[model samples]
Target: MDERSALGLLAGWVDAAGDDAAVIDGLVITTDMLHARTDFPGGTTRYTAGWRSIGASLSDVAAMGGTATAAVAAYGAPAFDAEEIAAFVDGANDVCDLTGAAYVGGDLDDHDEFTVAGTVVGRVDDPVFRHGAAPGDAVYVTGTLGRTGAAIREFERGNVERGNELFRFEPRVATGRRLAGVASAMMDSSDGLARSLHQLAAASDCGFAVEWDRLPVDRAVDAVADDDAARRELSTFFGEDFELVFTGPRAAVESTRGALGAPITRIGRVTDDGVLADGDPLPDRGYSH
Candidate 1:
């Protein structure tokens, strides 16, 4: 089965397994694993790998509108260079700093391949869930889309330096925290905006109608794609942006933008029908591995 389908099966077997993170008491916890060979492209730095892996887990906490507290990593690799290991730790620490979280250290093991398993702990005054969006709610996304997609394309073209700039994404921790009181539903767009909308729609039993013109397509996509249509596809369907996709009252969403002093784009509205882009049906397309 595909990753989403497998996860769906697991969710069916487990209780309260659909959220981005697990909330216990007032703490929110989440984890993620990254395989070096699969997740990182050739020429990717060890530092970038560590940063992205840890940040990915923290992004889940952010999706729940949580304030990150601490994080740990489990690293497995073959006989790797000591400098590479040091750079990896530094990257993890840097990401923790960005999220206002502590790097508590973690276990390391020798293996045939490189891999990282990361976990983050956080707290939220009011947790947002994918299931909370109501019809008529405004759907918003933080920052521009397709940056990672552009980065990947650049990497494939041997422009590793430029690609790294987009690969190392900033998790929307601060914005998410500020949105806690306002947003009704929230999730990180690591799975691409299109698939994310589908997931949110399924969770909330509501659909989405996104405005094509309103999507914050990153200009970086222009460097990778041939035309506007391809750029739009990359921005909407490529994954690993690490930006928050949220829903709230239109007024509250505007207030959130002012409160956080961050870019928040109104992309769509929640609805009773199926997902649509510019009134046309939008497929659930994104990275699934």
Candidate 2:
């Protein structure tokens, strides 16, 4: 079964079934695992891997509109390289620093492949959820899209410098906090904007109508693809951006954007109808693993 299906089978026993993180007595907890062979690219550094692995779990806390408190990781490798291991720890600490969390250290083990499993703990006063959206809510996204997709393409093409932009994503923790009071529903776009919207719709029991022209396609995509359609595909369907996709009243969303001084873009509106792109149906496309 897919992750979602597996989780669904056990949903009845959990306090929160479909959110990015689980909450218990105000504490938010989440975990993520990464395999070096599959997740790390040729040019990816140990530091980046460690950072991304820890950041992935922290991003779930952000999705819940929580402040990170602490994180721990489980690292496994065939053999230890002192320098690389130090770099990995440094990277993990760096991400924890960015998210205002502490790295409390973790366990190490020997394995045939390199793996990192990171878990983060956090707290939220009023946690935002994926199921609270209602008809007429305004859909918004923070930062530009397609950066990750473009970055990966650039890396494959041997442009490491440019590709690094997408490889290192900034989790929208601050933005998520700022939006907690206003957003009716919230989630991070680690699964691509289109898929995120679909997931939100499923959770909220509503629909979204996105305006193609309003999508904040990352400028970096221009370097990767020449055609507008291809650019749109990458921006909308490729995952790993770690940006926030949320919904709220139009006024509240606008005010929050102004107050936070962050790049929040209005992409669409929630409705009773199913998801659409400029009035047409938006295809279900994104990263699935």
Q: Considering every candidate listed, which one attains the maximal TM-score?
A: 1
| Residue ranges of candidate 2 with Cα displaced over 4 Å | none
TM-score of 2: 0.95
lDDT of each: 0.89, 0.87
Q: What total of clashing residue pairs does each candidate reach?
A: 0, 0
Output the worst ten-in-a-row residue range by lDDT, candidate 2.
253-262
Residues 29-61 of candidate 1 have per-residue lDDT tens digits of 988888867788887888898899899988999
lDDT of model 2, residue 191: 89
Best-fitting candidate, scored by lDDT = 1
Q: Assess every candidate by TM-score.
A: 0.97, 0.95
Tens-digit per-residue lDDT, 80-113, candidate 2: 8999889989988998898789999999999898
> How many clashing pairs does model 1 include?
0
